[model samples]
Target: MNPTPATSLSALREVLPQLAHPDGSPVRALVVDDEPMLADLVSMGLSLCGWEVRVAHAGRAAVEAARGFVPDVLVLDWMLPELDGIEVLAKVRSFRPGIPALMLTARDSVDDRIRGLAAGGDDYVTKPFSLEEVLIRLHRLVQRTGVMALDADELVVGDLSLNVRTREVSRGGEAIELTTTQFNLLQYLMENPRAVLSKAQILDHVWDYDFGGQANIVELYISYLRKRIDAGRVPMIHTVRGAGYVIRPA
Candidate 1:
């Protein structure tokens, strides 16, 4: 009952990142947690994000909701009355393999993280978490799923643009060429404008690479993107010290 959620809807809206389906529909979200208060809170918070949301209290109910709701993202609690979150995740993913799932739990051990992720959870949130944290994580998860987008064909921030279909990029009406890796990196940055993306996130989404050892690849590609995307223009991409990179209007 002591959930540390954002103080007000205004605060949530101000801090929360905006996401949209390419078709201009609200994001569909499913909340599965046996704790009624927690479930309700998450459902309400997601609704405030302008998402279409459904809540379930148990694993079986979660799967049923997954079928009827056909949610685009899932916030699933690991321990459930009947089937547990891992089982529910598998069942839901059987029909919707590409759906992004964020697992909720009190267990913070490395083993559990590995287990949840191995079982197809796209992200993990420890218990006693804030609604803001969950909201931010959900934004990252949906973006990684390749479903949430600013527009169907292109993502734009100020004059910077990336065409998802044609793989073309431009800034201030000038064509900018990029290599395949650099293009993917810039595309990811453009997709989540104004949101800080960690190097680990960049590797996972842009390269599908493991978060460790090869993180330098992200930095390298980012530098390449800057040289091309920001050359002779006001910079659109920025680095958040100790956090990650974000793209926004100059």
Candidate 2:
């Protein structure tokens, strides 16, 4: 039997990990579909999963939204009026460049899929798709192109070095053993060194959107990180008092 909407939503939460702005804000998404009902449906579902969503009903409006929304992902319909999906994708690409896009359309043929992929759609879904399928595809797309898609294999902040390709972390040439969660959390901080990140921000980026744990969980992990990453070394992870946490040179 097909899953219920609530079941599908729960599956989506399992698939798409929470991604937050450095300040721990919800990850932004832009939905471009002339069909108001469909657009609103997607927006509402994603919003329930903690995404900050925006909608654009026209190709031009979609392109304009990309400029300011800076969406982490774009859900675009292929047969848009005025600009068509390909043209809108191309135009948005000039600005967003590597932003991931999922192309939606009634076109299910191989040729149509190829054209959409060539036009820079990261994923594609045919019309009459279930919301569950859309959410699953979206999760895979973000995993492929979002935070995990590093431009460089190695990340460096002061004496700290993280090899993205190797999943390795070291400080001052000494290897550091970190749990998978710790590793991901450290990578997030390393990516945005010197930025004071609040607990909400950390949870959003490092945990699942549906995470029900207390915010102090962030404090617990931060303490764990300090023990493994700092200990005797010159501390790089710092608390900003009323602010949050920052990773920078001592």
The top-ranked prediction according to lDDT is 1
lDDT tens digits, residues 19-131, model 1?
Answer: 67545678899999998988899888888878889999998988998998889898999999999999999898899977889998887899999999999988898888877
Give the alpha-carbon lDDT of every model: 0.81, 0.80
- Candidate 1: global Cα-lDDT? 0.81
Residue 224 of model 2, lDDT score: 95
- Count clashing residue pairs per candidate: 0, 1
Error of 2 at 172 (Å): 26
